[model samples]
Target: MTAGVLSPRARPRLGFLGVGWIGRNRLEAVARSGQAELVAVSDPAEVAARAAAEAAGGCAVLPDLDALLEAGLDGLVVATPSAAHAEQAIRALRRGVAVFCQKPLARDAAEAARVVAAAREADRLLGVDLSYRFVRGVPELRRLVQAGELGRIYAVELAFHNAYGPDKPWFYDARLSGGGCVMDLAIHLVDLALWTLGFPAVRHVESRLFAGGAPARGRSGPVEDYAAATLTLDGGAAVRLACSWKLPAGQDCVIEAAFYGTGGGAALRNVGGSFFDFTVDRFRGTARERLAGPPDAWGGRAAVGWAAALAEGARFDPAVEGVVAVHEALDRIYGA
Candidate 1:
């Protein structure tokens, strides 16, 4: 949560390793931020690679990771499928290139640890676009909670229910996606809650996962379309999380988090089930105060922030360890 999304320091040369929609969108965000130079892009699909390159005002469109690394990039943005995130990020790091990857970081905690270890070994900057942290009201909530304004927070309720989920085939395959709604949507809730609460230790985790209206027996089996989990953090705080995809949710999405503490309570809720509009409210007795509201351009701030930090010569941030922590909690939720 800096003043500007992009750094004002020297612009770093960057490459996009996967130019699918998310990849291309982040590329455009960085390009628009003017914090980095787009050197090259590579994707297995020629259409996507070329489209992303064109979107960057015609950067070099290469064939693969090798060509991208050979472009002399100072940084790489990995937006491939979930299964590819860890390996691609590791390869980029080993090449001495900084990396900002899309979420899940890896399918599970072990894979995530490997990527983080690689980044530490290479002494490079590693970032993941967990995106929610950049949301306008979210950072403010984090500030309040960490500042002890929300004294002794005892409970957190978070949810993300998407009316229409991923349209990709890989998402339905647990091996490819890691998990369903939980992996795709609930991950944000988990990250936001932990990050806001300053990453407390999870004393225990319990959960129920369902896919196709049946229990998801194992992580390696069916992909969960609905999930509800409870995380008991140190200090006896209970974090409740629920997420689903293609549910009869009556709206586009339901994304919200409510925090209750001894001193006060606050909540961040979406407006009209719109993904982009959100409001944060503080509650004292029966009264409420608005902390933040819509018209905030936060969608791409995570990607932009990473690039900006790179321009400022940031390297090997220890905060990347939080990524590992998030995935570890995910593992426990899946009964690991």
Candidate 2:
């Protein structure tokens, strides 16, 4: 069916699975947007579920995915652990429910492909919360590069380092969280690089992983606390990525993505160690011009876009294949 804008009374009913901080945040955003009706919430934690239900205008609190599915949901919002993402999304899709899920989408490329196939078979919408693309600076930078304002793009550098590690135990488990820094943080870098460069075929990938200041012994060993990788795009552009947790960087966080071309360069960087505030600039010779900056409410844009797309009757977009491409790159990085 051709997509069109939805009215309030015609909005799709949505159920939230895993009402953690991120989940609730997205729930609130979707709830406030009036694009979807939040009809149910599911979380193993009673307190979290209750909070989410209240935020969702007293929506039903169900016990699990099955119960939520039975509540007449038209879509599912998944904020569960990384390992469970693929299975949960596939189940929802098989039952004909659209899904907006947190990133990594799956533990690996094989799992990601299954989910994509299910969505295609079911003719349902599938979205991943790669929130970085929704940021204010990203699209503008993309415009410049695509317009050739950056000339022949030669090199790109991306990094994300967090002073504190995840408080959840699952984040440290290799099997559950996928990998450490690469999966959590560098995923954004890889996505931005490939996306802005128009999804060029990645020709080669070389990587080194480390855990607790030592080289990781094996895939099944400790999850890497630090990771660095280089990707050579088919068009000959070089992309480098690095990310870490508890790096003693003397800051709360460090995040940057810089692209260099033969004519000029452009960058998006966090301001003063603040994660929420950012600045984008273009460089020409020794001079620089600002493009965009702070006070950008970007965290919830991806979720909001998904809800709006669902409202518009979008189903099984061909762009979903990008998720598999990203997972394939991650697989090569982890040597899985």
RMSD of each: 3.8, 2.7
**Model 2: number of backbone collisions:** 0
lDDT of 1 by residue, 87-113 (tens): 989988888888999998999999999
Q: TM per model?
A: 0.96, 0.96
Report clash pairs, candidate 1: 7-308
Candidate 2, residues 1-336, lDDT tens digits: the string is: 212233434789899999898999899999889989899999999999998999889989999998988877888999999999999999999888889999989988899999999999988989999998888978999999999999999999999999997999999887898888888888888888888888888899999999998998435789998988898998899998889999999999999999999989999899999888999999998999998898898888999999998888787898888888888888888882
Which residue pairs collide in model 2, if any? Answer: none
